[model samples]
Target: SAWLGALAYGIMKLFGPITGLFVMRFNNRAALMLGCFLCSVSTLVSSFIVSMEVLYVTYSVMYGIGASLVINCVMVLANSYFDKHLGFATGLVCSGSSIGALVLAPLSHFIIQTFGWRMAFRFFSATFVCVGFLNCCVKPIKRKRKGDYEQDKNNTIENEMSFEAKVSKRPSLFRNRAFILWVIGTAFGMFGYLVPFVHLVSYGVTNGIPVSKCTYFVMVLSGATTIGRLVSGRIVQKGYLNSLHFIQLCMIVIGVLFMILPTITSFAGLLPFIAFLGLVDGCYVVLLPMVTCSLVDYNDAILAWGMLAGTCSLSVTIGPPAAGALFDIYGNYNIAFHAAGAPVICGALILFFIPW
Candidate 1:
């Protein structure tokens, strides 16, 4: 399962940009629906895997296509739904992902223990089918009048100017200097960021921690992320300057959390870390809106967001494996924590210099 997931994730990065760019240019609604279909299909296929290699091929590779498709379209859909409350709306939308993690992580355990892993896969596939059907209900917003169309075009012009001015002033980013740096730093940062959460149970097992007790860490993290989404959204809405800077600040906290994570010896100690990580994770979602707003116009928000997510997904694609590889080499994840802090720090510094 692990290998299959990794294989899927690794290649998904390669295809993400193409899929995202194509969706932005062409029929976005169809693209969005297609993603949902892929997710549903991937889930259905997973139930039939007979070997680890098959698991990797279907769940990892095919499901990756579904995840990538969903993410690209969802960003565009989010932009359409929220104009005044972009940050809050994005936070609300992203909260579902963390909520799913919190609920499904436990539910999967129960299903696997009682029925079988295959049944668990089938259940997830069924859930995606329902979600896809719901997405089909989202009709394209029709411009009813010539005046409305003109107004929309004007809004697009204004937003484009706002973004162009920002980007024009920063030749480094346009020349691809800062963008390249940002991508590299973020990618490296991701490598170490997820290790603690993914390996928390194993770490506990190695320390003779009970399975039940160790599972609580996952719950704590998910709960923290859920709460964090709302809290960070509120904060972003209330504030005015430098959302990217705020993101950097939150990333710093995330880095510190990982750095100190190994010191936690009991559930109580772990609780704060889990919650803090979740809160910071939540802020990252809210930051997407702020970042998009900062870099592009309100009118082109959907396309800009698609590009942003496609770029950042690359970082996510690399982060976990880098952390895993570090563990393999060093026999401890301490170095990984330190490594995760670097990209965030660099990202912070880069945004600090840019005109927000």
Candidate 2:
């Protein structure tokens, strides 16, 4: 499952630049609607796939295209609507994933137990129909015409875009020192960040924990993630710290957490630690784009976002397989986890060099 998820993300990187360009050039709401529909229809179609390779083609490739579109569109739209409170808005919106995890994780698990995995997929398919409908509510801010001096919401958007347009003309993102460092640092930072979530349940089960208890570890993580995102968003919006601080701190924290995961043998001992991991992960995801936006011109933020997406996609693709191969060799998650964590530590150290 982890490898397939990574593969799907890797496939999306093929479309990442296109998705970013589309969101930047066209109406993001329209792009999001199209993406939502693609996601829904593809998921509905996936219910009948029998072969694993076919599932990869349909579920991974098709769904990943839609997901890449939706991901970039959402980020662009979030910045458009709430530039003044970007951190808060992005965090709140992104928390939808955590909310889904909190609700759907247990629900899907229950449905799979009661009915089957197919039914669980069908159940999610129905919810996505509504997801497509609600996505229509997003309204992309437009470029304002001259003499539009009325004190209105659209005027606020125009004011923000006008400032961004000025900033965008100053320099190219490719030449920005901050952007280059952030991309390189984050690519390496991801090396260890996902190990626990990918292997947590199986690790717990191997250590004599009940299957249900192990599953709830993910639930606990989701709940903590919601809280972390809310808090981090608020903090960023308030100008408490720059996004780099959060990313660097999370890389260091998550690296340490990965090293400790293999040492934990009891369920009780893992909860506080996993909760911290979730919190760090929540901040990391929310801050990743926020940091990119900070590093580059706002007018070209979509391109920066695209680059970051590709970096992340490549890292996740290689990281899990690397960890898995190490596990195959060592016959345990310990050495694999330690190896995974080393790059994150290195990434954290690299972040200190960012000019921002």
Candidate 3:
């Protein structure tokens, strides 16, 4: 089950760059509609699957591709619509994922238990169709035409120079120092980002916490994450701190929290740690696109995001299993937690040294 989940996640991230190309070739609305169609059809087909192999094809690959397209399009559109208040707008948009997880988790559980897993998937299919309808509400941004630039005779030379510079520097996206640091730092941070989410409950159980109470840790984390997303966005919008600096601080805090997580033996002690980690994690997530926008040209934001996602895929895929392997060797989660914290801290330090 863990391997399957990882495969699904990995596949989704692997297709991030492709999704970017799709958006660039077509348009946001088309990409979104296509994503919605893929997701709806994949889920509907998954409902009738009888074999694990078929499940992988329908649930992992197809569903993952659809999800990647949807996510990238949303980020690109959010960036396009709001510039001045981009942070808050991104937070508002990304928070929906956490909200959906909170709402659908139990609802899906109820449906699966009451009816069956097939019914649960069918419900998901219907939900995606509803989401497709909502996608139609977003108007596509009108691209500027070459003739439009010709009408501005006074700034024609300047516009031409700017366009030439952009074309010439297009390849610099991969070579830019700031972007390189950002990607490295983000990759390291992501390496261990999902460790706690995957292992926290099991860790609590091993420490003798009641299974029922341990489950609430995730809920608490999710709720705190929602608050963190909103608060972080507001902070960025208000210009209280640089978004990159804020992201670095969040990474450091999360790293420290993970390192100290194993020291807490009781359920009550773990709640505060989980909540704070989730809060910082949430801040990091929403700031991703905001910071990506700052680091690259507006035209390249989506592609940069896609590149970042693809680069982090390996780290995210192996992080949890690596932690699990450590547990197998050490007979406890202490080393695993420490291992998780190390990369995040290193990633923060890498960011701290960014020239910009």
Candidate 4:
């Protein structure tokens, strides 16, 4: 299931750029609905698969592609409507993910225990398809006529030229130096970010923590992330800090936390660390969109965000397995945690050197 989740996210990232373009070129509502439908269909199909290869195709590839569209289009829609408070809106949109984690993990766990895993997938498939239906409620934001873009009567020709030049000076998504730095830094930052989510339960079990208690770690992470997203969004919205700087700050803390995660022996000791990680990771998620909004012109937010996600998707796909492989090699999660954290520190350094 863990590998399946990662594979889904990775596939989503792979499809991100194309989905992004679809949203930008057409309507977010339509794109989002398409994604939701595909995901629902894929999830439904997964319930019938009995072989590994079939599971890979149905869940990992098909489901992943659909999920990616949903993730990509949601942000694009958020950015489209909320310009000044884009961070706040994005935070709210991303908070839905945390909330889903908080509720669904436990519910799915319970369902698997009570019935069977296939039933759980079937249940979620129904829910996901319902969401696709709900997407029909979204209405497009009415754009103004082209005449609204005409020069003001009070403006001189030279002033109009200057304004045009200034607007044009804001580089396109591919050409923006700050955006490139953001992508590069975020890629490295992602390399170790998923380690805790994937390994924490097993690591705790090995150290004698009860499965029941360790399971709530997911809740803890989700709760903290919920709070962190709201707070980080507000910070960016209010201009308290640049989105990139806030992201780097979170990464620095996350890096240090990963290094310390393996040293704790008690189940109780793990709580605070996991909570803190959740908060920081939540902030990281919200800031990713905020940073994209900050770096690009408003018209290009969706495209830039898609590209950014696509870039980081490479690291997202590789990070967990890389950490797991280290665990196999070293016989302890100590090296894995440390290894996961090291690149984030470097990613932060890269962000620090880049003049946004």
Candidate 5:
């Protein structure tokens, strides 16, 4: 699963930029539906795969292609859908992933116990197909013409007729200081971000905690995340709370909690820390897209979100293995936790200097 995720993400780097640019120029609705169709078809194919190679091809390659398209498209759509409550809207959209994890974790075990893993894939295929078809109901928002661009959304009118002319005429995203720093800060913070969750059970076991207790810890973390996603939405609605400041605060809290992990002795003692970690971790997914939209024009959605996801994919690829290596070398999780937490804190500090 780990290697497949890495392969899928690495391949995404190639396809994501092209699809993202296409999404920016053309119809977001169509591009999004196409991605959903691809994802649904890949899921269906996964149901029939008997070999590891086939699984990798379907789940990794096809699914990555589908997801890359869908993510960029949705970032554009969500930016347009709720202009006044964009942060809340983004949070709700991202919460869908966390909600899926929350439900599917237990549901998968139940399904396997009742109908086996093979049947679980069949069920997943059916569910995804339904979701894809349902996504077609999303209404298309027409893009402003070059003539109307000046009056709409502060965008200037550009008369470039040729593809090369248009390509040469587009604004330089790399020159934007805020955008560049935000991406760098996110890339750093995202490194080792998910490793704690991946290793929590093993950490518990190493400390002589029972298996059942460790499972409960996982449940608590998931519950905390669900609540955190919702709460962040509400927090964003408050005019006094700056979105970037809130994100930085959450990161600092998460880093501090991770640093203090060694001090927890009992399940009750760990409960608060796990919940705090979830609450802080929730900010990244909920706030990132909305913040990105605020930084750039709505038309820039494809490139912005695509770059973010691609950067996030790179972070995910590098984070866990680095943490594992630290553990392997030290024969302890202290170094790993410290290493992970440091980047998060540093990222938060970097955000303090950023205007957004």
Candidate 6:
């Protein structure tokens, strides 16, 4: 199950670049409708599946691709709507995932226990259709024309020409020093990013905490994550720190937390660490697209984000399993947690080499 989950995540992330290209070729509304359609159909089909192999097609590939499209489109739309408070906007928007986990996990669990997995999936499919309808309410922000008609016409022409030039030089994202550094650094950071999420509960249970009580750890983490997203976005929006520097700081903090994670065994002792980790993790996610936008022209920001997501897919895919494997070898999670911290810190330091 763990390996299958990881595979699904990898497939989702691996399609990031394709999702970006799809959005580029079509309007946001069209991309979003396609995503919704795929998600709805995939979930509906998954509800009827009797074989695990078939699940890989319906749940992993189809659902993953749909999710990638939806996520990438949301990021692009968030970037489009706000310039000054991009961090805040993104944080607020991205917090939905944490909120959803906190709210839906228990609901889904209840439904599965009471009804069945199939019914739960059917409910999900129906909810997605509702989401698709809600998305229809989103309209592109129209810029109000101002000044003389001739001035507006000339400005429009210049803007179109500039956009064309940027599109023609799409390969420049690779040649960009900052972009390259950002992608590499982020990829390394991702190596340990999912470790805690996947293992923290099990670690607690294995180290004397009751399984029932340990579940609250996830709730605490999710709640803290929501606050972290909002706070981090506001901080960046206020110009208190550079987005790139802020992300580096968050990565370093998360690495340090991971290193400290294994030393504490008590529930009380672990609470603060879990909360802090959620906070910093939220900050890191909220700042990712903001930093990417800062690194490239607005026209190319989506592509850069796509490339980063695709490049980081490998590390994200292997991170949790690698941690699990280490635990298996050592018969303890101490070394596993420590090992996870190293790559993240190294990645944080690597980002410093990027020229300001």
Residue-level lDDT of model 1, residues 1-356, one tens digit each, is: 46676667655555556565556445456666777787778878888868776777677877887776776566546566555676777778778878988888878999999999888888888888788778777776632332456577765665566544643443333244444444444444555556676777776665667888888878887888888887777777777645767777876777777777767767666667677777788787667555654464443444444545556666776776777788789887677666766665555555555443
Candidate 6 lDDT, tens digit per residue, 108-179?
Answer: 999999999999999999998998998887775533323445567755765566545545745768899988
By lDDT, the best candidate is: 3
CA lDDT of each prediction against the hidden true structure: 0.67, 0.78, 0.85, 0.82, 0.74, 0.84
Candidate 1, residue 59: CA error in Å? 2.4
lDDT of 5 by residue, 122-215 (tens): 7776776777777778876655533664565433334335555565777877677888788788778888576787788878877788987888
Candidate that would win on TM-score: 6
Clashes of each: 6, 0, 0, 0, 0, 0
Candidate 2 accuracy as lDDT? 0.78
What lDDT score goes with residue 290 in model 2? 83
- Model 5, runs deviating above 4 Å: 9-16, 143-167
Give model 4's clash tally. Answer: 0
Model 3: number of backbone collisions? 0
TM-score to native of every candidate shown: 0.82, 0.88, 0.92, 0.89, 0.88, 0.92
Which regions in candidate 2 have their CA more than 4 angstroms from the true location?
Answer: 1-3, 143-172
Error of 1 at 332 (Å): 2.7
- After aligning candidate 1 to the native by TM-score, how far in Å is the CA of 307 from where it should be? 3.9
Residue-level lDDT of model 4, residues 34-95, one tens digit each, is 88888888878899889877888899998888888888777656766776677888889999
A best-first ranking of the candidates according to their lDDT comes to: 3, 6, 4, 2, 5, 1
